[model samples]
Target: MIALLSAPSNLGLRPPQRGSVPGVSKAPEALREAGLFRRLLDDGATDAGVVLAGRYIDDDDARAPGHVRNEEALVDHARRLADRLTSILDAGDAPLVIGGDCSLLLGIGVALARRGGAGLVHVDGHTDFRHPGNSDECASVAGEDLAAATGLHWPAIADIDGLAPYFAPQRAVHIGHRDDDEELEEVRGIIGLVVSAADAAVAASDDLAASVVETAGTGYWLQIDVDVLDPEVMPAVDSPDPGGLGVPELTELLRRLAPRAIGASVTVFDPDLDPDGRFARLLADVVVDALRTLGTAV
Candidate 1:
């Protein structure tokens, strides 16, 4: 059975204006409004209930270690989220975590690590491996999630509950990154397989799925940041990259990939930019379709 978990945290996205409207934090409610949970339940999933995070506070302090904005809040939220995920796993129901941003990947990583380690399949537009020292915008935790998950960043976030390198370097696969940053090269050195967007676009779905499953080992978590879709179809993200996978392509990939995952997360979709809620509905349908595929796999 699959259960939906809502982790509405936007601490990772630090808006320049203090009181700017929340983006990713509104994703869970938006998706729910689009009938995501109902559709999943109708397709045979049980309601796992929502796990709400604390309110998001934008702290402009540059003095935080690693230049992480809302560092304390981020750490606290991650810890809380880890606990929630562990409980979900203990219940034996696959979790469909709806996220605030990519930073929630840290919490999910920690949860899997505590339960005896798991592989990570990161499907997104950016590598999300930037260190605070290298980034021009020094405060967004969203940009550093992969680094923290791999034990490359601050101990507070990386070594949650005294665990470090949540998943082994060899057990992680990053797919669909388009950025040409040095961090992508750095991640390539550590991650087992780095499938560029161009490579994934050309590769057969079965081949790509086989590679990701083989690299991720027996158990793994799948993370999908909606920005992986082309801007023409998914322009509601904070940073939309051009020339991304089409919705059909991503859906097919997920159908092949998700069946091997212990759980999955959908992140970085900002309903604020999607005024008509078209993207939300599209995202909801994709998730429901993936869940249906997963049901068949199990």
Candidate 2:
């Protein structure tokens, strides 16, 4: 069985404008309105409900080396979100987390860390490897989540509960990053493997899945940032760049890997960009088409 969990937190992102919040905070409900919740329920997924987030302070940008935007609120949300995921996992169900932003990985990291350990499969358009070590502009955790999840960031966000490096670098695999990703070399060197979207275009889908699954070991957590899709297909993300995958490619990859994952998170979909809600329906369709097989192996 699968458990649908919502973590509607936008604390990790910078504001769209000085006084406005990121509409990513409304993703869970947008997806719900698109009938994802109802469709998943009909497909045997249980609704675990929403994990509300803290206020998104536009001025919360903390570039003070060791601090991140929405420091306390982000930490608090991660812990509470972990509690919800832990409960779902404890019940022998695979969690399909609807996220507000990529920073929700912090909470998912906490959940996996507490229960022994697990590998990670990160699918995003960018490497998301900015950290205090490499750069001082590490204010938005949404842009630096992969680095923080691997314990490469400051102790404040990385070493939560004294369980740093939620997913070991050697056991983590990255796929679907763009060919022009700035941090490609660094992330590939640190993470177990990195498959560029260009590589996935030529290689077999199952082969890509095998590489990630083999390197990530078993019971890996799957992180899918929708920016991995072509901006023409999914321009409703916080960051949409060129050189991303198509819908068929994404669905094929998900079908091959999702059933093997212990849990999964979907992030970076902004309802504000999707005014007419067509993108929401498109996203929901893709998820159900490819990820209905989630938890089949577990």
TM-score top scorer: 2
How much does candidate 2 score in TM-score? 0.97
Q: Write the per-residue lDDT of candidate 2 for residues 182-207, one digit (tens) a residue.
A: 78888978999888888886789878
Each model's lDDT = 0.82, 0.90
lDDT of 1: 0.82
How good is model 1 by TM-score? 0.94
lDDT tens digits, residues 150-257, model 1?
Answer: 887778778878889997888999988885645887888899889988788889999998888789864688889888898998899988889788888888899898
Which consecutive 10 residues in model 1 have the weakest lDDT in total?
289-298
The alpha-carbon deviation from the true structure for residue 54 of candidate 1, after best TM-score superposition, in angstroms, is 2.3
RMSD of 2: 1.2
Question: Which lDDT value does model 2 have at 56?
Answer: 82
